[model samples]
Structure formats: C-alpha cells, structure tokens
Target: MAAEANADAVLAELEALSARLTEVEAYLHIEEARGRVTELEEASAAPGFWDDAEAARAYMAELAQVKGDVGLVDRAHERLSDARAALELADEMGQDGAEFIAEAAAAAEELTRAIDEMELSSWFTGEFDHGSAILSIKPGQGGLEAQDWTFMLFKMYMKYFARRGWKVTVNDCPAAEVIGIDRATITVEGKDAFGMLRAEAGVHRLVRISPTDAKKRRQTTFAGVEVIPVLPDDIEIEVAPDDIRVDVYHASGPGGQGVNTTDSAVRVTHIPTGIVVTCQNERSQIQNKAACMQILKARLYELELEKRAETLDEIRGPKTEIGFGNQIRSYVLYPYQMVKDLRSGVETSNVDSVLEDGDLDPFIIGYHRWATEQAE
Candidate 1:
C-alpha cells in the first residue's frame, strides 16, 4: 500500500510537471521556434548564405537558440514519458515501484528547473541582448575609497562572469596612485552576456569602514558601471575619419619589454561627442588601436540606442555624476551587511557572498523580471 501511495504521489508530480511544461512550451512558442529553425536551416544550406559573413553568423546564432528552445521542450516530454513507462512496468511486474517513483520525481524536478530557466530567458527580447557586452567601471568621489571600490566592483564582476562560464578581457585598466584602479574597461563574451548585464549599468553605492583610514569610521563610496552591447558587423555605424582623433602613447603597466619602452598604447577620441577610449592591454600598437576602435564603436552604438529610446538619462555617459538617487543598487557592509537593488526591491543580508563570491543571480533575475514588467 505504501509503495502504491508513493507511486501515486510521483504520478501526481509528473502530471503537474507535464502541465507546467505545456504552459512553458506555449509561452516560448515552441512551434514558432521550430518553424524558424527550419527556415534558418534551409537558408544555411543555400550557396549564397555565406556571402555575408556577418548575416550568416547572426542567422546561425538565431537558429541555434531556437533549436535549443524547442529541444528543451521535446526532451522534457520524452523524460516524462519514459518515467511514466518505467512506473507502469514496475507496477505490472508486481514489484516495488519506489525506485521508479523516485526517478520520476527527480525528472519532474529537473523539468521544473528547465522550464524556469526558459521563462527567464524569454524576458531577454532586446535588440542587442544576444551579443557580447562592453563594460566599464569608474570611481566617483570618496577619493581613495572610491578608487578601491572601483577595483572591488571590477573583481566582483570578473568573479560573476567566471561563475557563469563567460569570458572577460580587460581592455583598459588604469591604476590609481594609491592601491586601486581609477577606471577599467572589460569585454564580456558569452551567450546573452549583454542581456544579463545590461541591468547592471548605473551607479553603485558602497558603504563600509575605511580600510585605509586611521579613524576606523564608516565611509561611503560610489562607482559607475556602464554596459553596452557589442554591435554586430551588419549594423552600419559610419564614423568619418575627420570626426575622430587618435593618439599613441607608452603603455603603462607591467608587461613585456616593449610595453613601457615604446608607444604601444592607442587612444581614440570622438570629436563630436568628446568620448575618448584607450586600449593599452595589447603589446602591439596596431592591436591596441583595434581594441580602442572596438570600444569606441560600442560606445557609439549605445549612444544610437539611447537616441532611439529618446532617453538620454537612461544610459548615462561615462562621466555622469554618481550620487544619491542615481544609484540603482547599494551594498552596505559597515553598520550592517546588506545588498539591495532599488529598482527590483530585492534585498539580502548576504553581502559577503554577493561581493566576495559573486552570487548575483538573484539580483539579475529580479531586475530582469522588473524590466519586463516595466516594458509591458
């Protein structure tokens, strides 16, 4: 009787999982995704598909995403069917069905998690959400404290990317005279990197006891995080040669022999917008110049996006003042340890885990849901 009861419970859970999976499939438009996959496959087979490398890459990426989405639903359905069949076989054999019941329960739980992830992914419907991202962090006010805060922010984000299996390359990082960085630029590459990190753009406030101060008093510091999507090759961004200025200088960092000996760093300034980008991470001047250009283009693309949105305040420039209500989130480690996102109303007291360990999924999920609600 207990085995029969356990089997019934497992069957009930499986039914619930199947119903939820059906809903998820409907929401994800699995049929539409499959159709798009078919279309992309046909296009890929055409001889002219590779003529435009940029468009071909975009199509392939889209095809992969759509196929993955459809595949998730199909796999979930198959797992549910297999679990059901196993349970039935055990029952027909007049044997203990506890093992099959446990398997069914585990499969149901896995399906639930998969569906939730799919739902979260569906919120990323932005124009550039599918591409890589250019991220920059700059300190503001609080003197040395702010500089240290900037470095801390940089480390936190690097850890976060590492946890997510994403790749991050530091394009430029200028060290402060004290013990931290003045500003840093990084390019994060991964699936939906832009979509996931775009919400992180804005001012971040930190309150903690000053490690460098002798008074042992609490201090507040600020850092600005800017995230911009890397524009695809198909996007036409025309920057006239006459509208920009380029300068080369000696790279300032511990590197190979020629890094500090010669002028290997490149800085590009857009005359119209007064936006300047520098790249010194690479050893070669040409490589630095190319990296600088990539950053410049990403900035320009962000400006274009802001213009289309008709909201300049939404995407603040690199030099925007960071204070007061400008901060989207705050991390308090002094009087108490708490991290809170104002926009999403998500708050947690696990400041150490968030900062040192880079546990940011809760904040990201909250912000994504908030942004989706705002969009609607």
Candidate 2:
C-alpha cells in the first residue's frame, strides 16, 4: 500500500509537469522565439534603418522588448523542463524516495500556474498590440444627450487606462457647443495597448433618460469608436512627394463641407497607396500637413503589416451604432446600470462603477480566453 501511494504521487507529479511544459512550449516558447528571430532578420535586411538617430533608438527599443519577452519565456520553459526530468527520475527509482516526491509535487503546481500565465500572455501576439492605439469617439442621435454620453465614454476609457498605468494623449477633440465632444481621437500608449483596447473598437450604445427632453423620455444614443495601431517610424513605406495630392482648406467648427478660417486644414492623398489622411487641428497648413503625414505613415505601415500577417478580420467598419442593432457593447442606465461586451459575452451590473474606475482586467481576461479557444 505504501508503495502504491508513492507511485500514485509520482505519477501525478509527472503528469502535471508534462502538462505544464506542453502548455508553455506550445503557447509561448516556440512562437515568441520565432517572432523575435523574424524581427531581427527584418531589421537587419533594412539597410540605413539607423540613419535617423531617433528612429534607430526606437527600433532598438522594440527589438529589446521582444528579446526580453523571449528570454523570460525561455527561462520559464527551462525550469519546467528541469522539473519534468526530475519527476521522470523519481518515477524510475520507485516509491522509496519521500523527498523526491515532495519536491516534484511542489514544483509541478508552481509550473502549472506559471504556464497558465504564459499562455495568457501569448494571446497578445497580434502585431498591433505592440504599439499605441488611436481611439476615436463620435456622438450619434439625441442631440445634447448623445454628446454628453460621448464625453462619458471618453472619460471611461481614459479612466480605465489610468487604472492600468497606461499613458493617454488626445490627438484631436472637437468640443460640442453645450455639453460634450463632437468628435475626438486619442492615442493610448503602453505595452499591449492595442490588444486591450481592441475589444472596445466598436459601436457603444447608451440608454438613459434625457434631461434635455422636456417630456422625460428615455433616449438611445450611439457613439462610434475606431482603434488603429500606431507604427514605429523606421517602417519604410515611402510616399513620393509628387504622388501625393495636397489640398488646403479652412478648419471650421461644425457646418457644411467648408468652414473654419485661415485654410489650416490639410489633406494628403498618396495615389499609389490610395491612402488619405487629413488634419485640421493645427493652426498652420504646414503643421497640419506634417501631422497628417505622420498619421498617414503610421496608418500605411499598419496596412502593410496587416497584409503581411493576413489577419485583418478584427478591424471594424468606419461607422458604428449601438444596441442589438449594431454594437459590441451597450451601456444601460435607464432600466438598469450595466455594461455588456458582446464579443466576449462578459457583462457587469455595476455600470457606474465600471465607468467610474474599474481596471477592465476582467474584460481583458475574458477576451483572452475567448481568443485562445478560437485559436485552438
């Protein structure tokens, strides 16, 4: 009976260890190592990528981050491998060894948890997750109430990023006349920023009693969100100056096709790439063109990168609406305060608390699990 007990423990430990190693090797080690190697090779192939000091520094920084992740996962796999070997040795030696049984059992549990964490990290392998993400929010129907709701959505995300220690930068914001934002785009920068925010790249619907309406009617409002990954400057998809058709126009607040004063709005069209970007926030045409060009380069780089990956299914359409009609999440305040993420099917009854300042870790965790299931 004692011999059987020892054998049972040994077998359990070995099984656990084997499972852990398999998870890490399959989920993280192989793919992460391969990705790092590919980046290094591509960086080497691009001659004069280091010509610009700032761009060179950024490129090196990215390479270092990838290398660091690879090294960490490699070391973890090595530890798991060692534990597996130890368990195997104990299994062969028979039930006489108590110390070996205890050591293997403890190591097996540790490896299991570590492997699960690594598997979670592996789902962030999407190329866009490495860079900053651009988030745009626009109001839908319901006049001032819709505008106010848009501002609320903006604040919710900003607060979410703050809780996660992520940096947020507002690129352009058109303030509404009375209450909220007319339209806005912000850049959220941090590790896996795009990955975390990808779940938010759809229409947001809000239901509430409109204070603006004298009849005290419950109104539904829609807000559109767009998320784009910002690319590093070393990306070399060149746009010839002559191939770009430049158009200068006034930057107005909100009217028909043409508005604002000074012809500060600048639009650039790259004929070859069929890419167009416009900037009207800057005061001068030159500054607008420069900003537009910067965004254009990043967008074009993202396009090329997506083409290489052949994974463009996550990107949403230009316009977004809310509720069961066309939205990924719905914020309900009239009937009850709740927020539901459609993709991950994660919902919370405490909408106010979530919007006020929950870390959004639950949503991310849910999304990661869903993505892993899909991949499998």
Query: Best candidate per TM-score, number?
Result: 1
Shift in Å, residue 7, candidate 2: 26
Model 2 residue 15 CA deviation in Å: 13
Give me the runs in candidate 2 sitting further than 4 Å from their true place: 1-26, 30-63, 66-118, 238-289, 300-312, 317-324
- Model 1, residue 94: C-alpha shift (Å): 15
lDDT for each of the candidates? Answer: 0.83, 0.71
Model 1: per-residue lDDT, tens digit, 1-376?
A: 8778878888888888778788888888989888999899999999989999888998898888889888888888888888788778668755566677777778777776666667677777777776789999998878889989998998899899999899888888877777678788999998789888977888999999999989999999999998888877767788889999999887764122334667888899999999999888888889888888888987888788677976654443343578766788999998998999999999999997889999888898889878779878
Q: TM-score per candidate, in order?
A: 0.82, 0.63
Identify the candidate with maximal lDDT: 1
Candidate 2 has an lDDT of 0.71
What lDDT would candidate 1 get against the real structure? Answer: 0.83
Off by over 4 Å in 1: 1-20, 42-58, 75-113, 253-261, 305-309, 313-320
- What's every prediction's RMSD, in angstroms? 4.1, 8.7
